[model samples]
Target: MRQSPNDLTPGGQQRRAAIIDAAAQLFNEHGYHQTSTAMIAERVGCAKATVYHYFRQKPEILFEIHDQWIEELSAHVADTSDDVPLSEFLRQVFRDILQLMETKSDHVRVFFEYYRELPDELRAVATSKRDHYERVIESRIRTGVDTGALRPQHPRIAAFALFGMCNWSYQWYRPGHELSDREIADELFEIYFAGVRAESPASP
Candidate 1:
């Protein structure tokens, strides 16, 4: 389990949060290797030691960034109830993921780029959470297929295809572009679930 960093005083906790926030943006903008601790400190307007005071190493920050996200996301996925109709549950799951990525696009980018940069031990922890994420989505897809709510297909392929639609949003999705996140997710989910072909025959 990742340490909460809650043992620190309120001020200390705030500083640590600020450091992670700055580091994620820098790491995402300038590749983790290109971004240095000094740049992180400069961005946060704190001394280099202060940065070190909160985190012993840059990898810890990367780990923390991933930790913060996966912990919350995992919790959300866990909370998804299987009691609902399979179709309803699936829509809820993707919308929840879209909301998360929209709210923390920078963190999403950092995780996408620097997840492998974490210490082996920390990467293992993150990897487990990712696996859990996959399992939850995969299970939902299988259930949908079994219930006739979805087309017959490989569950793992369907699961990752859904994941791809949400995960890739960090790359080009922006606020107030032509479409809202919900709008894009709605259309993407419609395509993934229903396919591109017209539902009715053409009236030629």
Candidate 2:
């Protein structure tokens, strides 16, 4: 019996997902400029045209993957409460980013590699989303400064430095190695906070 589109069985859904997954993996491994749609189709065991049916072009597929990843990251960061101390909040933020990178390594690779390839309009959109994430860190730094928890410094610069430290981890962080994500987060936080935290209050 011929099945309608709505009647696709579990196997069909799995196959579709497999195609997307394969494309994402290949794009990450080889970079967008290097990976061809034909390669993606071959990896997915589908015709090149079929790959087009799912994604109009390589850039569209890359955008889709990036969109999904940023959405999830935004949600994770949004869930953090304002009540938490700055240090704890920063810890959670780092942990969330590390966990996402560890689990979605391919997406992370594609995100970093293809960011500049996006059109100006799309680049603006992507940057806006990223800036939203950065604002959270910036706000925390500002709060710490206001409360005298951290040394007085330019919040924006401090925030950028913290983000740079965390974001660059994708370059060298390897999964299944000795250091767990939590350990990496802890070490990173230690290095960052030790430098930024205010010195012991002058003896009263």
* TM-scores of all candidate predictions against the true structure: 0.87, 0.84
The CA lDDT at 178 in model 1 is 84
* Cα lDDT tens digits for candidate 2, 1-204: 122324566777566567667877997778778889899989988899877665666766666667767778789768877777777887787788788778888888778877888767777887898888788779888878888888889999999888888889989998889998888988998898888888962210
| Candidate 1 local distance difference test against the native | 0.79
- How far out, in Å, is residue 153 in model 1? 1.9
Return the top candidate by TM-score: 1
- Over 64-104, each residue of candidate 1 has an lDDT whose tens digit, in order, gives 89888878877876876667666566666667767766787
Count of backbone collisions within predicted model 2: 0
Itemize residue pairs with steric clashes in candidate 1: none
